[model samples]
Target: MTSAASKTFVRRLGVLLGAAGLAAPLTVAMGATAQAATSACTAGTGPYQAKAERFLGRTVDGKQSAADCRAIRDFQLDHGISPAIGYAGPVTWAVMDLVSQQRAAGDNPNAAGRCPVNKGRIACVDLTRQLTWIQDGKRLKSGPVPIRSGRDGYETRTGLKKIYWRSIDHWSTLYEVRMPYSQFFDGGQAFHSIDGSVWSAPGSHGCVNMRRADARSYWSLLKNGDDVYVYGRKPGT
Candidate 1:
């Protein structure tokens, strides 16, 4: 991006959200009820849950509707935070600002005991944490972003691989789904953007799903032959 564009992007990101709720990018099922929403937002305080709910345009009772959780995932994706698996994790919690939490507490620059991959400018995918980030050595370049990988039977592959190809606008032949900003590393699995609703559940056939914004950022930072280290085990793996 040009300097002017970068500045414009930052400025856009800096824009504070108004009192109005965030528009749902994808359609949310009307299945969410007050009780169900309340239970979903049970991760924390009423105020915080309310924040997430209101942000998602759900009931202000701090209930987490299916749509609310999915909307949070969308927010995470847009901000480049990862395991786009929808849950109010540290990053999400902090972003919601409903509670007082340390944002830097769990950051594993070294990736610690998980699948620690020390490579120059690598995209580290921690399936265990459901997070992905780009790093140059120990320096984080892009994110420790949340991501959603393949589900139980269709778990994402672990170990080292290299980016072999990239498609800015690609379509999955088998699944016939739109995979925007795809960066293929493993055979069929790549880092790509998925629909907002996809993050509400443990899903994906066998790929890492990022937010379209994050995928675009990854496209800008990564290239063919770039080291792609996917490690740790997906939940329940």
Candidate 2:
């Protein structure tokens, strides 16, 4: 072949090879996406299938379906469960159970009279239900909101305490983490905001981990010397 013709052929071949390379990655990416979607929404029945179905308001047939998988997966993702693949496993069911109890509290979280009512402007932490609220002589000032207390070994201390310190932007030297809107009621444990999901599990290191918005609200509503009553028992602990 002539030099000019050979050069033109080489250019065309290069273009074709580049296009093929691009298509290869595209195809692999598509396959990976499909696999992920499939894994994230399995059809196999989990141990707590029936309870999960009932909690999710789905038909309690005690079986896993495509629809059930999707619904359960969504709930898992919302609550920050790992491998949120729509599995009705114990973790998912446990979270659902906690949610049910929280909802049952409704507007009157203190209806059971667990947290003292007469304390003027007091913060109540119900460790059993993983809930917290602020009340003033029976009037709900704020919350009944979700909270992630300390883990099994590092259970948040129970009993009446006071907010001894307040730091809007506190950094934990021990854990090397940022504790935003920290209000310390105990030695090292405090009410603070974490960047991660408050419902992620295993809980914190004796601190009451709150969502960002909830922590900010707590910062605004609480101050030094405010009463804090922590009661009940955290489930795993």
Candidate 3:
């Protein structure tokens, strides 16, 4: 269970960052409305929501912002990951720890090579194929996997990113989603694993989802600030 203090921390962080909406818990029927509200702010409208503004300022190829209500609107059009209040609760943290433990044991996803820790290695994944690979010394070492893309057609974006944010045991028990950046773009899509084979299908709303096994494997190889190359499908399609 999360200490009451931790819950407060998460809530404060959300409000200070203009991400208080994210802190709101999701519901089966109202979840869509909540996420859609994220993009309601215009470039200069409302109180200076620093987190929202910062997210909105970033552009994918000069387009898309974490605060784009249109993106939120798009999500409602098809429904997507609900950043419900408990989504980033204590359970998420625990799972991340487990994944870290397994990876620290020297398990290699592709048996290809070490994940690149250099300035030039290509770190990327293919959601269509459910594979996350690292650029070894000279080649791409692939890890077996399955991912959930956007069910609403807001596909996982294709781009270059550095590990930006991370949270353990997000959402529910044993589920952790590693975010390369803030969930600003398309409401901050994530790379996470769900409980069943649902991930193998187009299960996620827009996040790059993986199976529990594959997610665990990735947790071992990746770290914050690392670069990742996403191929096949644009993020938050």
Candidate 4:
């Protein structure tokens, strides 16, 4: 073979080797991710293992299993729980418990009559259940949706209040955060949308933190002077 042709062949071989080297790591990374997703399930039993098992309709054994981990992890991921490794920790159980409460509410969240039916076109917030809904007399207008209310020390004030102000693009000066679809009902407290998951531990500062869709719907359904009845104590507060 000619010297020039030999040199060209060597250059092509070098390029092929380099490309294979790069492809090898990429293939390994993809495989690792897939393996981690399936194999990262915790083997040790979580504190709420039995409760989680019961909730998920798995065998009532408190011990953790690969199956249990997969089931719990799926639930955690579905609820936006972070580090969703399938551990039945307090946070996971708390969310599951909340789901149970919401299911019990069914079609009539106001069946208990805790929220006064006399008020027309009012928004009712049940802090205990971490749920909120809008009602026009006896008619359910929207949600028994999950909410993240004031955490511990910053408990949301309970009482009958009215939305006195609204800012679609509100930027909080005190907290230095964006509070989208803000509807202020009491003091600095308001119904607002947060970027994070509502089920996140502890809770919000003092406002009713809702998902983006829920906040938008609330903004459209409610207006200034709309009655907002905030009652019941939030679990931790």
Question: Which rank order by lDDT, best down to worst?
Answer: 2, 4, 1, 3
Taking the tens digit of each residue's C-alpha lDDT, what string does model 1 give over 1-237? 666875565446435322223222222222443235333321223235665665555667655556666676667666545544355555465444411121242465444734343567789887766678887877778876667789889999988899999999999889888999999999999999986643345567789998778888999999999998888776544
Candidate No. with top lDDT: 2
- Candidate 1: regions farther than 4 A off: 1-118
TM-score: the better of candidates 1 and 4? 4
Each model's TM-score? Answer: 0.57, 0.84, 0.40, 0.81
User: lDDT tens digits, residues 1-237, model 3?
Assistant: 346765566556656646444433222223555456443533222232332223334333323333444443332232232332222223222222323333443434434333334555445565434456566555545453435566556666666676666655655223253332222222356666665443222356566666666666666666776676566542223
Enumerate residue pairs that collide in model 2: none
Q: Scored by Cα lDDT, where does model 4 land?
A: 0.86
Query: How accurate locally is residue 209 in candidate 2, as Cα lDDT from 0 to 100?
Result: 96
Task: Indicate the TM-score of model 1.
Answer: 0.57
Worst 10 residues of 2 by lDDT: 21-30
Candidate 3 differs from the real structure by a C-alpha RMSD in angstroms, to one decimal, of: 17.2
> How many residue pairs clash per model?
12, 0, 23, 0
Candidate 2 per-residue lDDT, tens place, 1-237, comes to: 666875576567647756754211111123554465345454478889999999989999998998998898889889999667677888889899999999898889999898888779999999999999999989999988999999999999999999999999999999999999999999999999998887888999999999999999999999999999999998888
Candidate number with the higher TM-score (1 or 2):
2
Count: clashes, candidate 3: 23
